[model samples]
Target: MQRSVEGQPGSPVNYSCTHSKLNLLLNVNIYSSASPHISLLNLSKNREFRVFFFSVSKVTSSNNRHRPGRYSFLIQFYAVTTASSPMSASKCTRLSGALVKQLLDSVDSILFDCDGVIWRGDQAIPGAPQVINLLKEKGKKVFFVTNNSTKSRKMYADKMTTLGFDVKEDEVFGTAYCCAVYLKTVCKLEGKVYLIGSDAMRQELEAVEIQQTGVGPDHICGKQIDWANVPLDPEVKAVVVGFDEHFSYMKMNRAMQYLSQRDCLFVGTNRDTRLPLEGGKAVPGTGCLLRAIETAAQREAQTVGKPNHFMFDCVASQFGVKADRCLMVGDRLDTDILLGSNCGLKTLLTLTGVSTVADAEAHQKSGCAERQGMVPDYYVESIADLIPALQG
Candidate 1:
């Protein structure tokens, strides 16, 4: 059977779908921009399918009349035979072509991870800038959410601009900035912070008028007893951990001392164990440093990064973003996809970074409910895969 779904008046696109016993093929025609195209969607035999229509409009000036708002369709196929069906769980479907358009059209805001998503180290991923710029051009709200605490929001924005991405300081949310916000707004912390992080973290804390000590390196000196008796700052009321290249035994001992205080608060940026870089390389992440401090202090830290809900809360509270209409795109499943699950937002995993299809499949097959959250709703070979859809 065939069914037709029309777009808004004056829109140059039209969608027609042909349904068969085991497959559904959607034919889309963009008369003004391109020729007709067909997108094939597989429907498992004997399964039920539901189609949802979501309208996504582009903001245009009054003088612009060539392009009009468009409507995209999302098709969700399910196997109703049993509740234990694999399709009933996480769909880790490959996102491409029309699926990309449908997913993008369903959301107003898109949150992206910095490293491994857009760029790694100092290099921008191929075609990443174009994808980001085009998404903004299409009137989508784009924000960068990274667990790396090595850079402040302004620093992140500056770096993005250099990498050819059109970004603003307000749109970047690194753990450094969020950590400062958490202390000031949530904890209502008074006095100083015993920081075990980078100078960027110190800058962010100071920006919020939160005094912080313990930036740079702290060398080990004297005997083991002397280290145990290390002087503690009387005004330090909190211990904040982030990525520190100079992490040493002395610094860990100092953080434990501050955390030992009965009323001292403990916070960490994120628990990401590895920061993936270009060419399949990686380095120890901030989580390693945070774990060391936590072990020594014998206390768990209140993390303010992904999968913690506070990070999403920070974004939602600022821009009035609705969780239902947001998409979180990242390379890691444990942090990015889990954050989306926690926030009730759609998630897409890209292969350009950490985590693989095997990892996601393992989570999906595992009967554990907690592991299921790590599986993404959809995945793409790379964020660049969205470029074709955006261009269309």
Candidate 2:
């Protein structure tokens, strides 16, 4: 058993202050006959590990018969100490701003998102074309990934080309494409699916020879559902939910009823809780549907999205790219950033879409920081600014 005592101020004479902040320092002691020694792991052989002395307190041992002249133990303190100073605030701010330009100078691959960051609501954003051109000029590998199941990669490629950017279907990644791959490998799903998504999702389903039809008990019924049509199809063997418009209570009620039935499988594209709107107000994303379904059925749904290894496996196998060598770029933290980081690939985030640095700061302040969790290694304001930032 292990015990932790916190909120102690100052260091005892036999104790060491491992950190400048007293609140963070910890002292551990075991009431034993011998003092335990501490060894450093993964430390450089050239540099010495520091240790200092503080005061110690001896108390009576609770165990009566086993003790001999009162056992001695050590109240040892340990922390990851650093004599190296952090960069100046001014310098950090400047470097943080310049990080993207520096990255462009180093990294050879780039991935982009189609909506919001590239084209917002059918219109190309400013600097979108220039960024693509710049990447091409540098001969950097580029790909596009999106959670929008409303359009196929081919359609997205065509749209990007029409909007004056050079793009290809082979370089596109979408939730619909990922779902098709997941259906192919994981669950081996087939037959008619009761789709509540856009024409794009239906097209993909047909391409895979999966039947798309009206809701019925005979088919492997599922919904590529969005906000407006979360309605559960009672006959569906699988409940496939995606991003839908016009989401409401009726749709959720239907989804609940179907999911509550025994032997039904539930699937969702991604678990993004909120999405960006035109004026910056965030609307609940697919995660809202996921929770409702989970609550109704009292279980978790099988998700197919970024940072989900199924998508990574499909993409890596299809391209013959090693997961470590591949780089993933996206605007959303839960999906894009998490996907790359989870799959052992380099991850990058941009401020041009869903998440912002302010949001990241808020998360850190909330006391949820992890040593190796879902944070992007790099961040940029936009793809267009990447080159300059890298050069600087």
Candidate 3:
């Protein structure tokens, strides 16, 4: 059976299926007023299924209105089948074999999360380089989007090259770069930033002609009152937070003092709490420091990294990437997959990072609409799993 629905120009349209006995082989075709038509086919033998399709449109918002007529769309797809079948809540399907190529053929651009999707720490996952190189060779536009704010775009590209991946600086978008772009282009701040991040963030801010303070250790040297009365930079107009190995109490106090000003803007890289490493080891991520700053400042920060549309905007604006023709592959369900979900793109979660198939299943069964966004449309054991499909 086939159904057609016309969505509002800038709003989302939702449809649900509740028929228990009616088996559906879903084929979704999206037509945009400003773009060409795109079709997606889902062949499923299970008794229940869910499908997500992204449509392109021009959405006008306070932050994005300057770029008029640009392609953008936001849609969230969630379904809880009423059928008694065991696969009813199993939307996170394992991707393998012929299914891999079929999924790859459905998108023109693929956004990969670096830390867990391609490499772990300093080592690239087995067959990861082949999969990435082959995807580019197949005429696919590949981009790396990572929330690790400790590295700039050039730094990330350099690391990728050393790890045997085909990458370029412009194709890499890390929070350190995106946060700087956000401050310069979006915020249009005229002064310096009170930054609680790494040296790489300082480099990115400098690249955009934005000055920043608070990169190194800021150890507390005096009493509480002295810390409260600490000197502040009058030119500082924003408080930017990211991954900081040298995060200290004095730094948090300084950020709080700067943010206490009503006009001072607050921004953060991302909210990922843990950074997963090889052999299942993990460490604190930027979220820990950002949260501390938020607590002290009593203010919420405008984050520019994953799960935020701004991250996708950084890539889409540069490459003219359309939501309908893009796929987001990442390891974490909260940041990576949620970014894809937030931006109206297909989401694929690999088990090589923080989230697992069981975690996705819990969200699927949670019956919470918001948590549903964290559930990816598909899950894979590893990105290396795609090598065979690319080879074939």
Candidate 4:
């Protein structure tokens, strides 16, 4: 029998197995957070087959108290060898088929989640820099997307550089930029927008020559509309949505009032139901606010996030790439994964964010099997694990 413990290299777990008469190999691969399961080629069964088990556990305080916190997944390949049937050659060959197929589907581009997958707030996860560098060295394109509307593209680029990752401003996409582009091309509002979100969002609106107003304006640019002391007017032409940290009941009421008016356009950056916070907590994202407005006004808002074809089209046009070739790697099933399905691109889901294996399993069992614009071809744990699969 052979045993192996595979995880990020140099992590707290030194990765050595102990057994009486067995050989083990520790193969470290960094897959994009897109894939849900860490696939292993089970070659231990050739000798003799007995029992196998899998479990996941967090690192103890004694280990390195940083990123990639030492998750040791043990695959115990047990073979109770007997004299009569010493080798089960057929079963070993059967196992090879499964691993090969899973590995063959790995593709070109790798998209990553900015928060938990790479960094927490301004802190980079352990091995994040190496993971980024490795992919770039191999000529694989790495794109990081975040729902964080608080920072500008420059802010993200600078922060990544500081964290030891080679990043370009254009490589990172934010909800604010997507919303701004959509508003410029679709709405074509030249007058004013009641601004919301952070300075980054404001800058994006300004770039499109859209004017800002306090009250009695043409449109409302709402960020955390629930928290800002926004002035409402009868002439408000549209209500735009994005991430808001200070969401409240009063804000919902104000948005409902504005949306109640006929001929008013409702727009949102993206409809991510929840955002990932440090320490593994869930917070409402733009989708939460969009739902409230839609429910109150009984109308749908123009969504401008991933999984929406417009965002994908804009990315292809701006980067000069084809949808069929690019891969959409994201954490959320409703947004990132959906973008691939909807745009005729490949979809990958990671467990580092909003959804889990159980959640994905339920989604699969519900008979929502790989439809045109809403299914993922693979599910991975994080971007760090995706590179190895891609290289092979």
The sequence of per-residue lDDT tens digits that candidate 4 reaches over residues 1-392 is 33434454221122334354433322322211121122121112122322222323223222231333333343444434433231112111111224423433333555665776677677886666777887677676777766677777788889999999999988887778877777676555444554435567777777777654322223335566533545676456667777766555555666767655544556777777777776767677778877886787676665666655566655666766554446666666666665655544545665666656565556655653232223356665665564554345
Candidate 2 on 1-392: residue-level lDDT in tens? 11222211111112223233322122232212222111111111111222222333333333332332333333444423324223211110212554455445545666666666677776777878777876777777777877777678798889999888887788887887777666555556543455545567767767787655332222223454543354444445556667666455555556666655534445667777777778777777777866876676565665666656556666566666564345676777667766664554556667778877666555435554331235566566776655464333
User: Which ranges in model 1 have alpha carbons more than 4 Å from their true place?
Assistant: 1-90
Estimated TM-score for each candidate: 0.76, 0.63, 0.78, 0.62
lDDT of 1: 0.76
Root-mean-square deviation of candidate 4: 20.1
**Residue 160 in candidate 4 has what lDDT?**
95
Candidate with maximal TM-score: 3
- Comparing 2 and 4 on lDDT, the stronger one: 4
lDDT preference between candidates 1 and 4, better one: 1
Ordering by TM-score: 3, 1, 2, 4
At residue 264, candidate 1 shows an lDDT of 71
- The TM-score obtained by model 4 is 0.62
Q: After superposition, how far is residue 40 of candidate 2 from its true place, in Å?
A: 30
- When 1 and 4 are scored with TM-score, the better candidate is 1
